[model samples]
Target: MSTAVTRLFIPRDTTALAMGADRLAREIAAEADKRGETVEIIRNGSRGMFWLEPLIEVETPAGRIAYGPVDSQAIDSLFDQGLLQGETSHPLCQGLTEAIPYLQKQQRLTFARAGITDPVSLDDYQQLDGFNGLKKALQMDGQAIVDEVKASGLRGRGGAAFPTGIKWQTVLDAVSPKQQKYIVCNADEGDSGTFADRMVMEADPYMLIEGMTIAGLAVGADQGYIYLRSEYPVAHQILNEAIDKAEAAGFLGDNILDSGKAFHLEVRLGAKAYICGEETSLLESLEGKRGMVRAKPPLPAIVGLFGQPTIVNNVLSLAAVPYILSKGGQAYADYGMGRSLGTLPFQLAGNIKRGGLIELAFGVTLRELLEEYGGGTFTGRPMRAVQVGGPLCAYLPESQWDTPMDYESFQAVGAALGHGGIVVFDDTVDMSAQARFSMEFCVAESCGKCTPCRIGSTRGVEVIDRIRNDEDREANMELLEDLCETMIYGSLCAMGGMTPFPVQSAVKHFPEDFNQPAQTNGAQS
Candidate 1:
């Protein structure tokens, strides 16, 4: 191995691509050639610190010095500044990539492979502890692997913090399937405040593939499918490439790792429907049907894609599998506090400075996350509420600042550490408008499979309007409360069910907005 090669790390994830990393990479390469530099640039998946996209790292005598959010215009300056030789004088430079507290503090397990190796090069992935878990899993009985996961306390990172071990155990105990058992990755990350899925897919594609392979081996699954959302076009492109590479390298094809496991994988995409983020809706889309959610009781594990025993796990949840398998479950599980286990990949977004992915053990308070890590509101305005979770998640006011970001603790305060996403809203934001938008968003995205979600969402908007219009604001508030109760009790999935949480929280937190007098021009004829 050429250990002395001048290594340059560039992000290739969707967010970085959206921020134009592709053009920047080409510029860096071209500039390197002009300067006669032997630059060995590696297009790795992002470190998930999205605020610093197009982040470039050049191996220096001191260490891997970093530069970020770089555009093509800065490439020439970067070359002139001796970036390949790592002088660290560029305008975009952020010295020592690893030293950034945001990236350093993260307990990166699922993200272990991310930003550490070439995303497409299976060899680089293998060099950095990739596929080792799958190999280790193949050595043991599948049941033993499942038991290890159960012990690790790794839960679903896609909103609901359900124990992964319990889900796997249930699937294992269900049957000794010699049939078409499937492993499905839910990559439909439509939630407004979350991009962890997109980052992982783009930054560490093979890690996800390897994680899926382990899940397949443990669950007797011979086929796997990833239901990627259509909005993540770049992620889809990268994942497709990774899958091909994995197959070529004998990691995802027939007799994968020569363990007699015939696991094959493919990708499916949803048509940008938010409801598709829900597992059932995702399965329906994966099965070549309309992305409508299926009623549960006959859960996806029992009757999943095309009527088979499927292991449907969120992208992060599945990605976290390798870590637990490589270093036993109890070892992974012993990280978090209370019922929450392991590290939470908290996605910080919206109206906040230092917005990016922050993965830490659960129990970090909202106040610390918002005021300290978030660096207050991006607008420099005082913050009013921190919407933890997704759009449906509750808008926790400043009063709830002390609430720790655990599932149960959040639930106690009419909130949730949903998918570990925290979207900050400044005081200037109109809560009534946000509440109305929540209802409107629900109406637009509802799968229409459930009555409350379909009709109640449309009605919720009008009810919110009634409160805003001062048509007996208190009475309208009561009506909206009734509507919330109906939606909470009646909706099929959490999409419609939890929409009320944010709406009501916003209204309760900012009551002045609901009672604001309608501004009318006197000259309106």
Candidate 2:
């Protein structure tokens, strides 16, 4: 009986659960009972490949035979068709899951543990190479851990490419006799076209906990907080539960693993404000206040969160720490080219047909990801502009597709791989409309602290209208450019400053869209 136990993993993300994985689990168990197949099923998170929800795996002679978008009703037919041995008549039988080019091409470093193990199971996590980093860190001094991380060449994966090791060393060097040090994980990823953070949190909560635990040990931080956005209510619930489990098991809380290290962690919820994704705004939210961006110069590393020295990092930044510590920093550092080092968990989202998460090295090009990896736009129409990063990022044309995806590579070409989100749009999409939407999104989500962001965003929309209506189109275009310049150089934070990135990139890439514009039903022209 033990030898016959074939393990199968079922995606249990909220979307999958809603689509009926829970009932399907029961059905699989019952069907195995009638068929006399010794199969053990474990629930895991999506591969960020949402189109394949309720994804089911069957232990087979050839490997795991996957059938997706599956529900309870289909389980009987699956078992009857001998799917356990890889023979299936099910319509959803996507033969040979590993060979699916989209899933196969990804490097899957940070996501190596995802979609493969029970998310909350400590045993499963450890078996799949989880706590090797924390164990390694426990054997080293605080500064040593910081030094190792410094060599990894990992930067903030949230957007800004600040070095994680450098940030930790600052908190370590800070004078805090009467002061307390904090480890804050920025999980408030409000950036559209990005769900890499959310996927990590849900797929492997233990990885995040282990990552944060390592950060706390390195930075002399006893208390840690994960500032998760409220929009990700499902992820918030999953991580919070995992935190409780970890605390009970002595992996978290005081005297962790009897190492005499007093470390405790908590989860702080964000209230759907986009600004909270910023570290200062996140800190403000943690302090029971509105999410407003704070001034810099005295960076968060020096003075932050209840006036204490804080080591704040993005979700992916911390998640990558475990791998860096386990496999020497040089191993992780050697992956990328030039300034951008280590592997990146790139999210292929929006209009793309094969949209999902693709982890790869820094040197890959936009064209490879969009054409080869993405399988073109979802509409099967000619792919128009592709937006790398989130809404604040630029809408670039095919002319820039050959450009590499490294930090300086994208930036040199006037685009960014912000949060590693690649949103594609087909030929039908008008850059002018998307550019206008960028300003509109800013107007809706800005924290209203800075005058330019609070006011300029609304005006930017009006100016975009002047061009869209073709009312002195060329003049309006110049005025819009000037307004963008003001917002870029004048605004306090990225809310207003980066709004120009999408707008100007749109006009630069597709000037024909703004020239002699089309008339809507309500247009005065």
Candidate 3:
């Protein structure tokens, strides 16, 4: 008689890797061999709960049982506790992986398959309805696919909040001079406190591939490029592997699924420039030029890659297409409130007790995310400020915490939900210094394509330093505000344009912080 092989799942995500998942996996396998046990170890993607990372799961008759925040040293202890039999008595055991409240509450449309299957397994993906969207797309014409997307109420997830269907419609209507259109996935996610894009690429890469394929079919584009950030080496490697596997499995290449349509995809690494996160700068980088923003008149949809029409969409926006096509557009659109349809994968990071990814409908308040999911500050101190979007966004005070997390609500509050990254700060933080850092970040990251972004950021940093030092503080404060105004209206791109958001918000909300001298070392003056 044969015995069933004990199957264990370990995360191969970047966060899990940093938390020693690799070492723990090796230890578990060695311990199993020593005990004469037949164990099959499968490396899966993260569930996005970083607090319980290095999370290991044991496959059982009921379901997959989870244990987490595990270290290599726990391997012996885990085995002795009948981990293979899915024992729950162990201190580390976290019950059924699916039942965990953190995961159970999420409306995981784009990330549905994440952490549940082997990332590179084509067979596993197929069984989980992976290519169903692409299969459906093959049966529909380009107009029908675009119409479905239009009905979904999908907007750009890459900070801009632009209508995604409108952009696609323009590309579909455009007539490329060379008869060549391209689909470009702007994966250069450089915002602070943002890792959702990396999670998608590393955890469920085929979702992105399938999304891009559907986009190609929709826009009559044959070539696609993922302009990925150079910092994510793991994502880059995984994406390439997934692309290759997809081609071999008849999901991509000269003829997809024996259909007459064709789409070829590849990943090109950026030069570590923050500016390339903008669509035009990414196009320039992909064309082997220096990463710099191009002025708009001939939009990328009309004159794009190699002077041909193109469809440029963010990682999250494209990743949502598979779900939209599979379940129908209105089904995906039924989640969020108001015009902000569908769920957004909000990344909770910085000083917080339980920080991870929270995918919810758009109507949820920042207070709910910060308190319920984030569990307040990590230091257990009073939460002071929350910086949504990225470095270029406003540092929101507690009074504004109740604002809903959709595009219009945030905009109405003089803030923009750029990339859904929320960075929390404890009471010890200095808002004046934070305001200064915003200007400094702009000076360092601006591509120098325009004057206001280049020179204004440099002058703004100097003016902020003057105000912090109490050198003509009142005069410098007014001067700083005026300079911020110039940058806001004069800059060519959001890089220079939105630099004032943090600075202006800080001065407006925390006026007392600027009245005193800046903190020295770790002490406030």
> Please, what is the TM-score per model?
0.95, 0.94, 0.98
Candidate 1: where are CA atoms >4 Å away? 1-5, 176-178, 518-525
Clashing pairs in 3: none
Q: All models: lDDT? A: 0.82, 0.85, 0.92
- Identify the runs in model 2 with alpha carbons over 4 angstroms from their true place: 1-6, 18-23, 26-40, 71-76, 88-91, 519-525
Global local distance difference test of model 1: 0.82
Question: Which is the leading candidate under TM-score?
Answer: 3
Model 2 agreement with the true structure over 172-196: per-residue lDDT tens digits: 9987766589999999888878888
Instruction: Tell me the tens digit of each residue's lDDT in model 1 across 72-107.
Output: 777877777877777767778887888988778777
Residue 107 C-alpha lDDT in model 2: 81
Better of 1 and 2 by lDDT: 2
| The 10-residue segment with the lowest total lDDT in model 2 | 516-525
Listed per model in order, the count of residue pairs whose N, CA or C atoms clash below 3 Å is 2, 0, 0
Per-residue lDDT over 457-511 for candidate 3, one digit per residue giving the tens place of the 0 to 100 score: 9999999889888899889998998999999999999999999999999999989
lDDT of 3: 0.92
